[model samples]
Every structure is written in structure tokens, then in C-alpha cells.
Target: MTERPVTQFGPDFPFAHDDWIRHPSGLGAIPTDSHGASVAVIGAGLSGLVAAYELMKLGLRPILFESGQLGGRLRSQPFEGADDVVAELGGMRFPVSGTGFYHYADLLGLETKPFPNPLTEAAGSTVIDLEGETFYAKSLGDLPSVFQEVAKAYDEALESGANYSALKQAIRTRDKARIKEIWNPIVQAWDERTFYDFVTSSPAFQRLSFRHREVFGQVGFGTGGWDSDFPNSMLEILRVNVTECDDRQRFFVGGVERLPQGLWRRAPDRMVHWPKGTSLQSLNGGALRPGASAIRRLPDGKVAVRDRWGREDVFDAVIATCQSWLLTTAIDTEESLFSQKLWMALDRTRYMQSSKTFVMVDRPFWKDVDPRTGRDAMSMTLTDRLTRGTYLFDNGPDRPGVICLTYSWMSDALKMLPLPVERRVELALSALEKIYPGLDIAGHVLGDPITVSWEDDPNFLGAFKGALPGHYRYNHRMYGHFMQENLPPSERGIFLAGDDISWTPAWAEGAVQTALNAVWGVMTHLGGRSHADNPGPGDAYPEWGPVALPD
Candidate 1:
């Protein structure tokens, strides 16, 4: 037998979604009879929308049910009376490593610009404030000596704790065997450890003082302040860094929401049941149905979904893309529909709290050089203060700009939950005033500020899953749901797809990849098959599947 090619993602199992979709083998076709079969897709977010669109191409009729807005957490709130100026309440940045999600963005013809992450070229300059000491610099080299030490310590810790360089090279070369060898051991070692434990226990971090760890927590490498993630599993942090999820970030030009909306309206070259020019919009009569309230299995084995108004629809299969918490709260999911093991996985899933506040400025005033130091007056700020991290967006020198006054998580986010938009803005401004001393941030504000506390939102419950120590078994169960061929028929039809179900949560690529997994599951359930040359995940599972977790 010919030797099979090694999997792309190896033990980390990110799901080589971009590779699979664009492969010459193609996703394959369904039987002509299966073309018009209805499939219920809950939540019109990136995952649901992508799955529905791909299924439509494969001859399946996907009926999307969304309880909230179509974009779900990819929400872009426009400034009052100013359509162009907006705030991204969720999922603002996209990383280049998320090739799978970008495939859809490319197909949609959406433009992207580099996100202004701290110390990146797009940020121009960055300010680091800790314990009443403030430092401003154009790049990492310009920061204080202690900051450089923190960066070096972090690098050394990764190299020591996890053979960082070898893993990076393995990932870069797509050396699946080497990647599995390096990553599997790390997963075993770190799966039960918190990020704080990894940091404090590392030899490199131990050489430094407690202050070093505190600074590292306040202003983390790549992104800002990782104190929010200190309680999460070290395995989760390692996956993010090794995959380069925090690097080379970009943002959708208009809004991330455009990706899903564009897909909804896009007319593909060919579709299974619809005419040549048909789009999801046309199929649904320009609107998605109301949210799904209940899901159960029918007597004949079909999945029955009920809308908010008690309207019932039965389909051959169902793909739930909503947050897992909804299974108990908003939706009356049948207990028998899922195995107790699967139910435990869904119930144990933990979501992190996040909050963001944005204010529209008259223009990119931060571009102006300060007369005293010849530096941009207001650099993208990362501080231990109440604001945590502040980002500035430049539409142009003359056009309106947006400032994310506070992008915080966990306790920081919870503090702002009780406050209204105006009060939140006031706290952020007060914090910034202490940092700048003389800048008039309030004067340039164009309209009312926009804010979001993801925890307050009923549909989401929280921002995204932050796997706790000892949660690997739960994650393993959730991520493996798409591979249901071995599952009993009673547990087969209802599929799960979302960032929350992927190995790497909070990234859009996770959502896209899981959607593809569900697509494969639905196609197979409906008597469809991927082409022999281009086998789907089901065909490749035995050889290239997710890493097996120890019970």
C-alpha cells in the first residue's frame, strides 16, 4: 500500500480546513436524490453560515435558525447616525495563521487591514504603564530594561518548558511526525497545569523576582495583559502561541460581520437544488427564521427542531452552532438526544467574561507628533490601570477614527457590567487622563460610546471557552463529536460546530474548521460521500485524527 501523507495539524489538531476545502479531490458531491434534503442549522454565525453555504453547494437544503442577530458574536455596532464609524463589540481581530477563516473572507471579497496590536508596525507606538511607572516607545527595543527582561524570560520559559524553537520549526515545515512528537509530550505534561503554574514553576521565571511575574501578568507578550488567562490551562496557552494565533493580526475593513452577511447573499457558481443565481438570501426569502427553542429526535429518527413560536420542523440532521450553555438555558434540548458523556462535556464547558468600550473620534488625532518628544501624542496603551488595554484605529488623517477605550477580560470585565455606557466611558477616560495628563480625549468624541459585556448577553453567556486545568477530557469529547460514525444511531444525527467545540477557542478559524467537520458529518449522514481522491475528515480519521486523550 502507498504510504499515506502525514496530517497537517498533527497532535494539536487544528483541522486543516483550508487545505481540505481547496484540495483537488474536492469536498465531493451528494446523490441527486439527497440534494433537496433539509438540514437544520442553528445559529447564523460564521460556523453555521459556512456550514450552510457549503452544504447548499453539496445539494443539501440548510434551514438556518438564529435566536439573535445573524452574525452572533461577530457584532459590529455602528456609531449613532454615522454608519461608517463603528465599534467591534466582539471578534475584532483576525490572525494570518487562521488560513481556514480567511478562505471564506477571500471568497467574500472583503478587504482587510492590519490590526494595531501593541508594538506592531500598525500600532506606530505603544505605552506600557505598571505600578505608577509609565514608559513610551516605538518598539520593543525602546521599552525599559525590565520590560526586555520580561520578554526574554518568557521566551526562555517556552524554550525550556516546551522546546519552543523545535516545535515552531516543525509547525513551519508541516512536519507532522515531529510536531506530534513535540506536542503530544507537552500536552501530557501541561494538560493539568494552569498558565500561572507553568510560569512560576519554569526555571527561567524562577531566576527572576516576583515583580517579573507580576509585570508579565500585567503586560503579556504579543497581546496585552494575560492575567485574564492565568486561570486557564497551560495547554490552551501553548496551543495559541505555537499556532501563532496572536501574531500578524488583521481586521475586516468594514466589519467582521460582512463575512457572514456576504456569504448569505453570495450566489455560487453551482448549487445542489437552487438555480444558478440563487443565494441563501433568496432561498430564505431575505431573512433567517427565528431562534430554535427546542430540539428532539422524531419517531422516524429525523431531528425535530422547534422555533420560538412553537413552529416545528423535522430534518434529516441538525447542526447546533450556538454556545453549549444554550443547551440548558435558552433551548429545551431533549435529554435522550445526546449521551450522558456528551452532555457532561457540554455542561462542563467554561466560558470567559469579556468587555469592550469604543468611542468615535473626530479624526486620527493620535497621529499628531507631540511638540515635547516628537512622538505620537496617544500611542496604543497597555496599562495595569482600570482600562487594561486601549487601541486606536485610523481611518485616515481626516476621516473619523475609533478608539477602543477599554478591552478587558475576567474581573476587569465584570466590574464594568453594572455600569451603563456613559459611566463606562467616564471610567475609561479618567484612566486615560492619568496616563496622558494633558490630552483632551473627551473633546474629540463624535457620538455616544458603544460598549458590550458579553456575560450580560443571554445568548452567548460569555465570550468564549477558556479551558480550565483537567478539562482536556471534556474538550476531547466536544471536539470529537463530528466523528460520529462509531457512535450509536441514537446519538448520531445532531452535530456540534463552533469555536467553543474546537481545540482552539475564541479564534474564528476554529469556528470555520468545526463547521467543515459538521458539514462532513451531515453529508455522510444523508447518504453523501466525499470523492475517493478528496476524502473528508471521516475518511481520514483513522490516520489523521485528533490526539487521543487519556481517561
Candidate 2:
């Protein structure tokens, strides 16, 4: 048999959500009496939307509540005059390993192309600038020997510190037992460690100079610099690497926001009890309710959610897909709904900062090669400067192109948090000028610059969850909340689903997987059961759930 490709099945919970959703048996069935039962879905983000969409197909009425726009982080903002040219302000690059997310994309028939990440053929060329030195390369081999050394050392460290090859092979083949056997112990061993700790302490890295480590951080192997995530958990980084979350990435042709929008408007052909023409959009009256301001468990055992306009609605089940921190800061959530330990996990979830500044150019001017150097005017850039990572998007010669002047995270992101879009573009151009001297980057610009500082957005709080050292217990609490049979009755109906609630936070696949978990939870709560042939995440979860660590 051919080996299955690596997917985000689980370093934590090895459930095949993609297959479950694709099953012809169709994600279980609810009783006729429970059909059309109301469920509240907070935040119309990817997770919330996925939960709502699946729930709708399961014959549940999902009332979507959103304080922000339809697509939460999959925001694709269009330039004023450019036809269909968009600046993806959030969740731009998606990896092919994200089969769960792509399942929906395929359902919607959205087109995708390789994202122009540094050193990939999609990028055409890559420029790395670090500590006042700049080097151009089309591939890793073309860079300095030090870069090759750094890449080799990191690979060696992965093999040395973790059973990298065997573990990845198990994940690829979907060997549930072997996956748990290898990954569970690693979780226990490294749950207390940070990514920085892993890198600094690894014998392979220790053998190299600190400069090598710095280079590795500045120009990370797959995407770009990961120094921003240096303080994050080693487990988090390992999950990304093993799952190939940062490799072989692609972006939606029009924009990723089309995904959630497509889901909202799509009428699934295989819906359970709903009419053939019904969709989440049609069910919710073509618009979502206002953002939920407060949530309380009523005396009658059902949950009541009050919208921003003081409209209180009751639901048999509620799924909260907002950032976990919003439970404390924005929403007035009842204290008794979750155990104090679970509340602690929600409150302690740390989110990373991120900023992106984009400008629409008249054409793909960056593709123009200079006769003197025989190099494109500029290339996908990774630098130590505030710009951090700059990506170029070419939209055929006739159409306008987009330039993400800078995509920075952590401290680098925070620097641009206070700046206006124009100022942000100016700062990015200044940084780029240092790399592409005498190039007319400013002259190619058309339309107003677009930018976003996710951390500054109250709705998001931060870009995505970045687990810190010793946060495994917290992650376990959030990720496994959907499997709540053993929990007290008061906490049973409220399910949590988001990338943050998933082991691999920041990846869309996490959101998709967790959403499926919530769908299973809600289905079961509503007196539904999966078909014997095709078990849902909840059915498979007991034996294949995340390994519990002693608190």
C-alpha cells in the first residue's frame, strides 16, 4: 500500500476529521424531535463558521453572532480601485497538509496557487538580509555555506532531540498507536521546555556558534524568521515542523476570506433535515446577529446569550469560537459555566502579536529584471530590519499586483502597532530601500496602502495563540473541552472550538479540526450518534484522545 501523506492528524489527538466529514454516512443524525433545534454560534470566524456550517447540515439551526466582519482572521481587504486585487490582512498562506481546510475549499471550488514564500520557486528569487549583510538566492544551495550549516544543524537537532524521522513516518502513515507512543512521551518530556531552550541546549546547535543559531532564527527553514516564536513552547514548534505546516503553502487565488464567505452562502447538497435550497445564510436571514455581549446559564438548564443590542436568545447548545481571552475581556461570561481550572487555562492562553502592511502596485514591477545585474528589481525579502519579511504578489501583467511590504511578528509587529498605514508603508519602503538601493519601489505604487496590527484589534486580542513553556496542561484543557461527557452537567453544553483551542494554534487546520470536534460534541448532546462505519471525532476520541498529563 502507498504511504499516506503527512497531515495534521495529531501530535495531540489522532482523529481523522477530514475523512469523517467526507464520509457518505454524513456525520451522524439527530432525532426528528431534535431537528431544527437552535444552537448559538459566536464569532463568524473560520472555526465558528465551520461549526455552524456542519451543525446546519446536521439539521440544527445555527444563529451566528459576530461583532466584527464575516471572516474573522481570514480577512481579505480589497484595494479601492484595483479590480479583485486584495491585500490579505489575515490567514494568507495555507499549507497543503491542511486537508481539513482544503476539503471546504474544494467544496467551494476556490482556486489556489503557491504562496510566494522565500526561496521557493513561487517566490522566483529570495533575498536574505541579516546584520548588515544581504545575499540573494533562488534556492538554499545558492546561499552562503553558513546558511546550509544552520539548516543541517537544525535537522540534525530534530533527529537527535526528538525521534524526528520515525515520528514523522508514523504521522504520515496514520499509525495511531505508534503516533501516541512516540508523541505522548515527547509531550511529557518537552512540555516544560521552550523553543529557545530546545535550540540552545541541543548538542547539534551547541556545537555551532551562536551566530549560526541567530541565522537560523532570522532565516528559518520553511517560511521566514521564527525568532518571534523563540519564547514559545518546543512542542508547538515540533508540531508545526512534523506536520509540515509551514511547507508547501498555497494561497487562495482571489482571497482566503472567500472560504468562510463561501461556507456561509453554500447550501450543502447532503444536508439532513433542511430543505435543498437552505444555507447558513438563508437560515440566518442573510446576515448574522450582532456580537454576543454576555452569556449565562439559565435556571432551566439552557444557555442564554445576549447580543450587543440587548436581544437575549436561548440555545440548547452554544459554541464559543472567539479568542479564549475574549471570554474575560469582551464577553460577560458566567463564572460557573466552566471549572476554575478550565477558566485558568482560558485566561492563561497567550497570543502572539503580528502586523502586515500592504500596497497595491500598478503591475508586477518587481518582476522586471535589471540589465546590469540580471536580477529582478526586488525579491521576496527576509531581513533583520523592522520589515522582517516582505512578499510580492503578481496578478498577471494586465491586472494590479499587491506587495506585502512587511509581515512581522512579536516585537517587530509591536513597533508598527502605533503607526498609521501611510507611515507603516513609509517605514517598510525605507527598509526595502536598504536592500534594493536605487530601485523605484515607491513609484510603482498605486491606490492607498493597507495595513493591520492584529494585536491592536480588540476582537482578535492578538494574532494567534503561541504556547509558552509549561502550558501543555492549559492546551490540553482547551483542546479537549469538546469531549465533555465526564464534565459536570453545567459545563456540558458549551463547546470551545478555535485554532487556539487546538494543539497546533495559528494554523487553519487546527480551527477546522476543533470545529469538527465541536460539531461532534453538539451532535451527541442533541441526541445524535455517528454511523457505525464512519465514527466522528467524539466517537474516536476516547481511545485516541490526547494523553492526559497529571495536573
Q: Give the per-residue lDDT digits (tens) of candidate 1, residues 1-551.
A: 66322222534663466788887656878778877888999999999999999988887788999989988888888888876677999999988888888888998889999999999999999999887888998888998877899999999999999998888777766776787778887888888999999999989889999999999999988978788999999998988887788888899877889998898999887566678988877777789989999999888899899999999989999999999999989999999888898899999999999999999999999988889988889999999988999999998876899999999999999999999999999999999999898999999999788999999999999999999999988888888888887888888889999999988899898898889989999998887888887777777766656577768
Q: Which has the greatest lDDT?
A: 2
lDDT of every predicted structure (CA atoms): 0.88, 0.93
- How far off is residue 18 in model 1, in Å? 0.6
lDDT (tens digit, per residue) of candidate 2 on 359-417: 99989998999888999889999999999999999989999899999999999999998
User: In candidate 1, which residue pairs get closer than 3 Å at backbone N, Cα or C atoms, i.e. clash?
Assistant: none
Off by over 4 Å in 2: none
- Residue pairs clashing in model 2 are none
Q: Model 1, stretches more than 4 Å misplaced?
A: 1-11
